[model samples]
Target: MTLLEVSDLRAGYGDLQILNGIDLSVNDGEYVTIIGPNGAGKSTLMDSIFGLTDHKGGTVSYDGEDITGLDTEECIRRGMNYVPQDDSIFPTLSVMENLKMGAYTESELSDEKLQDIYSRFPILEERTAQVAETMSGGQRQMLAIGRALISEPDLLILDEPSSGLAPHLVDELFDKIDEINADGTAILIVEQNAEEILNRADRGYLLTEGKMQREEGAEAMLADEEIRQEFLAG
Candidate 1:
């Protein structure tokens, strides 16, 4: 089932346009990645989906409901969550505090949800009282992801979750993402690490100049000589 669908999505910042009639979808429990060169509107696509950009045209549907132009809170209320590439966490808050803040929309923090997040990220549990600024980059990323998951979103949008992480930490972070998807949360990730992300994703979209160049199964895109030569850096 399609959990999120974006059609002819045109959005930008102020008068500057970025995405141009982009069409994309994420099926329930699927892992989808968007990859492209810098300034290709990859991140803009995420912003548009989360209603953070100026909506010029098109429709965004989630679970068969129209969500176009809805603010971030409305999107989150409708079982969607977004983690941007940077500045997603509160550096002054403790790990536990951040997780609790993620559940602010709820009447109260459910112990079950908190424990589930801790189970997925043990380091977070260990550092519950530690200030977020003191954590490692990978750990902070995990915390960001954990915070998103605290709401039990049906679809999770992640922008560059692996950015600035060590190679080994990137692998670990991807594994955690896989685990989260395995538990049935659909993921839409914008990533710069094309090779690693494509290897792990169920499908991938290659974007260039604010347009989708190709959308294909992960393995097929990885095997395409033209794609490797042009985008994957063969």
Candidate 2:
């Protein structure tokens, strides 16, 4: 069954359209990724789906319910979580405080949930009392992801989760993403690093100029000479 569906999504800032008739669907427990050039409207698509942008026209359905035009809170309440491309964490808050914030809507927040997340990210456990601003780049990203997981969302959207990381750290982050998916939370990641993301994604979509140029297995796309030339040949 499909967990999320976005059909003909058109959106942008002011009068300029960034996402033009974009369509994407993520199946239950599937790991899907969308990659494109810098201005490919990749992040815009994510923001639109999460109700952060003006949806000129489209339908966003989560678990067969139309969440179109729903407020950000409504989106989260519906078991959907979105992590933006940047500023995803509270800089002044301690690591533990940040994780607890993800479940603010819950009537009874559980420390057990925090422990579960800390187990997944041990670095976070060691730095629980430290301010988020004091952490290293990779550690901050880990905290951001850990915080999102605290909500136990049915679908998690990670925007450029590997951005700004060293090559080895990117590999480690992708490993964690795979681990999260393995534990059964469907992942929809938007990334610009075609080569790295394609290597790990179960399926990949190539978005160009607000349109889907191609869709195929991650490995297959990596193997294609034309795709390599167009997106990954750099």
Candidate 3:
């Protein structure tokens, strides 16, 4: 079943439009990745679906409900969680505090939920009391992802989750993400590192100038010479 769907989405920051009629979907327990360069509006499409941008047109449906133009809180209420590219964590907060904050909306945040996140990212459990900003870049990303998982969302949307990490750390992060998806949470991620992410994703979409240029199976896209030379070669 389709857990989330965005049809003919058109949105941007303000008067300036960034995404132009983008359509995307993530099925239950599926791992989907969107690839594009810096200015391809990949992030814009994410923001639009998560209700962070101006919705000029289109519909965003999640879990059989029409959530078009819904706010972030409503989006979360509908079983969707988002981790943005930057400033996802509170710099001054301790690791534990940051994780607790993720479930601020929950009336009864359980220890089991927290433990589940820690178990998924062991480094987060190891650095439980460390201040978020004091951790290394890779650790910080782990904390960010851990915080998002505290909500136990059905769909986790990640924007450039591996932007600043070293190549080795990026591989480690992707491994953790694979574990997350294997545990039954659907993933919709956007990244510039096309080949790396595509290798792990179930399906891949190539977006350019805010429009989807191609949608193909992850392995098939990686094997296509033209796609590799035109997009992944960068």
**Candidate number of the best TM-score:** 1
Task: Summarize candidate 2's per-residue lDDT along 97-172 as a digit string, tens digits.
Answer: 8988888878655979988888888999999899999998889999999888877888999999877877779878
Q: What is the lDDT of residue 116 in candidate 2?
A: 84
Off by over 4 Å in 3: none
TM-score (C-alpha, index-matched) for candidate 2? 0.96
| Selected candidate, larger TM-score, 1 vs 3 | 1
Question: Compared with the true structure, what per-residue lDDT tens digits does model 1 show for residues 17-123?
Answer: 99899999999999999988999999889989999999999999999999999988888899989999975899999999999989977988899999999899999
**TM-score, one value per model:** 0.98, 0.96, 0.97
Tens-place lDDT digits, model 3, residues 44-65 = 8888888899989988999989
How many pairs collide in each candidate, listed in order? Answer: 0, 0, 0
Model 1 deviation from the true structure expressed as Cα RMSD, one decimal place: 0.8
Q: What lDDT does each candidate get? A: 0.92, 0.87, 0.90
Point out the higher-scoring one by lDDT: 1 or 2: 1
lDDT of 1: 0.92
Residue 13, model 3, lDDT: 84
C-alpha lDDT of residue 131 in model 2:
98
Clashing pairs in 3: none
